[model samples]
Target: MIGSPEHFHQLEKSLARKLGIAAFQSGLQVLRNDRGWRENEISIDYIWMVTIDHSYSGEGGIFAIKYKESKFREKVNPGELVQGIFTNKDEISQIYTETGTTDLRGIFDFNLFEGSQGITLDGVSYTIRISGQNIDTFISLSNPNTDSWKKWEAEIWALGNRMALASGNKEMINLFQ
Candidate 1:
């Protein structure tokens, strides 16, 4: 999914088409719900920090979609809301504006991961759980019975941050609010 921005765009387009415009629109709004600030004038800068380490093995990155309002407050974790991102284990890393301990080192598979709440990705099923918004975001695939489950923790992690947008139009307004 890296090296080709066009590919990601195409994938996004395909997903939008498959999921439908209304669902996608709702999803985007839901995605924006995680942010603390929102408005009709400001814009949001959603930056995805793509990285990796020894433990986790994926091309996933942290997303920092800024706010688009005059209000400057802390962001919250959206468990089931949010357009393009989710958190099953809200405890894995601090999100929005908390302690700023945004260093994640494990679990790189799905968008959301928690305790016992399983979601399938690339044929592998994972358990996702989140303590709450701006709380514990965790994902566990630990099951001695299966090989896939054993190496789940050190493969995926989802973290997010926020900033602020200064300008945009009506159509672009819906982007990173």
Candidate 2:
């Protein structure tokens, strides 16, 4: 039920707010909810953290896209909601921003590894995954092919290009190139 026109529209506005764009407009996208996963009843949601801005002192970084999915049963109306406001001090690490901790390393390979490296671009520190370039392969290997996966890959690619142009760090630029 995700990635309909309405969903993208919502994401665009969410991005604008996080990036501090009062009147922002661009052909920018963040992620796509893979259909195979979405169809699975157990698939609660997916979340991603993309850098929007960073601290001037370089102590930490800020993320604009705290992508999330909330489950709702059929015929349930969650109601309208305001956009989320995030800051560097806030706990933006995991989708579950809870205090409890559990050792999931042995449970899933996906959670065990730090797939992406953190980089600063336009004062925004993006967590770039080296394997994201091959996200297509990952999807194909793990799930059925779908347009949603293509969009997800494209969005990550676009994010890398944008990050490269805004970043002064050669190492960060090189990661994408």
- Number of the top-ranking candidate, with TM-score as the measure: 2
lDDT of 2 by residue, 97-149 (tens): 22112221111123222233333243323232111112311111122123443
Global CA lDDT computed for model 1: 0.28
Q: Give stretches of model 2 more than 4 Å off.
A: 1-47, 50-145
Q: For every model shown, what is its TM-score relative to the native structure?
A: 0.22, 0.24
* Per-residue lDDT over 32-150 for candidate 1, one digit per residue giving the tens place of the 0 to 100 score: 22364442222232212222211232221232222233322454433221223221121112112222333232333433333344543432223333322233333333332333444
Question: How far out, in Å, is residue 119 in model 1?
Answer: 38
| Model 2 worst lDDT run, 10 consecutive residues | 136-145
Q: What TM-score does prediction 2 earn?
A: 0.24
lDDT of 2 at 26: 20
lDDT per model, in order?
0.28, 0.29
